[model samples]
Target: MTGRAHRDSEADRIWQMLVGLVWETRGEWRRKVSEATALPFSRVRILWRLVDEPKTLTQLAVSTSDAPATTVAVNDLEDRGLVERHPHPDNRRAKLVSLTPAGRRLIESARRTVRDDAPPAVQQLSKTDLAHLRRILERISSSER
Candidate 1:
């Protein structure tokens, strides 16, 4: 193979490995969070997004990338007293969703669960190795923007 083709093939292999690792770690994290919080991964995702501030259903839909699913999840969260809707100050027709105290507590617990439950392979990384990995990952992430 030509040099360019070889480089592309190597890049593809690295990309695939990175993607696989991410998906596996994400799945494990999701499972742990769900078990810890007794909530579905989707609901947990919405709660995490709301941790910063209140948002309209439309905003949540956009962030979640599924308007219909976001609406249903919000309804469920509201019914469970984990979230509440308030009138949007700027738009009379819109309501802003915010996490309730219960929701906040659950989210805190979820955060702890995730923090304490790093996958075995990650947990085994030495500090020096982890720092190097962090730098590489940060560079990759920064390139996206």
Candidate 2:
């Protein structure tokens, strides 16, 4: 708090701070991943997306907001034997994406950082604040339509 009259309100400042924090957080995450893991960020995201359920390449690309390179990423993973793309159960032409044993193992290793290193950070936040923040962020992330 200073005498300077910032045109922005406290909420705006907090929002911008959170954005910068996100960049810092992701940067750190990327560095650790690059150092400790062989998978690329895009490959990891595709694998994580399928953790819930299988999806076609089209669905994965749209859901992940990945562009044309989705094929390249998925293909790379497939070539590495990390993921297997096969004909969609319902649609012959479309291909479904899922994790192979290798893919799941890779994501499992990534989770070690969060589980082993971040529980204390999570404990510092009040449960109510964490819940409220999650709700707000989820609502904001929904499609505008």
Candidate 3:
């Protein structure tokens, strides 16, 4: 192969590996969160997003990629007292979802559980490697916007 072709192939391999790792890591974290919080994986994911900030049901649905699923999960969470749905200020038809104090605590516990459950290899990553990986991921994430 030419130099350019070789470089392209190597880049493709790296990109594929990175995507696989991201998906696998996300699954691992989700499972750990579910086990720790006693909540379904889907609900835990919604809570994970909301722990950062409040979002409208429309926004959550868009982010989660399934309006019906998001609506059902949010309704279930609301009934469990883990989330509150309030009227959006600007949009009368929209409702904003926020985590309750109990929800926050559960999310915190889930996060800690996931961290503690990390495998030996992940736990053994050096600080420098972790920081460099974070920087690379941040760059990729921002470029996607």
Clashes of each: 0, 0, 0
Off by over 4 Å in 2: 1-17, 113-128, 131-145
Give every collision pair in model 3: none
Who wins the TM-score comparison? 3
Per-residue lDDT over 58-120 for candidate 2, one digit per residue giving the tens place of the 0 to 100 score: 888897766678889888989988889878878889988888998888878887753324334
Q: Cα lDDT of all candidates, in order? A: 0.91, 0.77, 0.86
Worst 10 residues of 1 by lDDT: 110-119
Q: Judge candidate 3 at residue 113 and give its lDDT.
A: 65
Location of the lowest summed lDDT over 10 successive residues in candidate 3 = 113-122
lDDT of 3 by residue, 1-145 (tens): 9999999999999999877766766776677778888888889889988987899988898878689989999999999999998888888998889999988998887766677455556669999988997899899899999
Best by the lDDT measure? 1
Question: Candidate 1 — which residues are off by over 4 angstroms?
Answer: 1-9, 91-93, 113-116
- Tell me how candidate 3 scores on lDDT: 0.86
Q: If both were scored by lDDT, which would come out higher, candidate 1 or candidate 3?
A: 1
Q: Write model 1 residue lDDT over 22-141, tens digit each, in one string.
A: 787787677888999989999999999999999999999988868899999999999999999999999999999999999999999778767645668888999999999899989989
Give the lDDT of residue 7 in candidate 2: 42
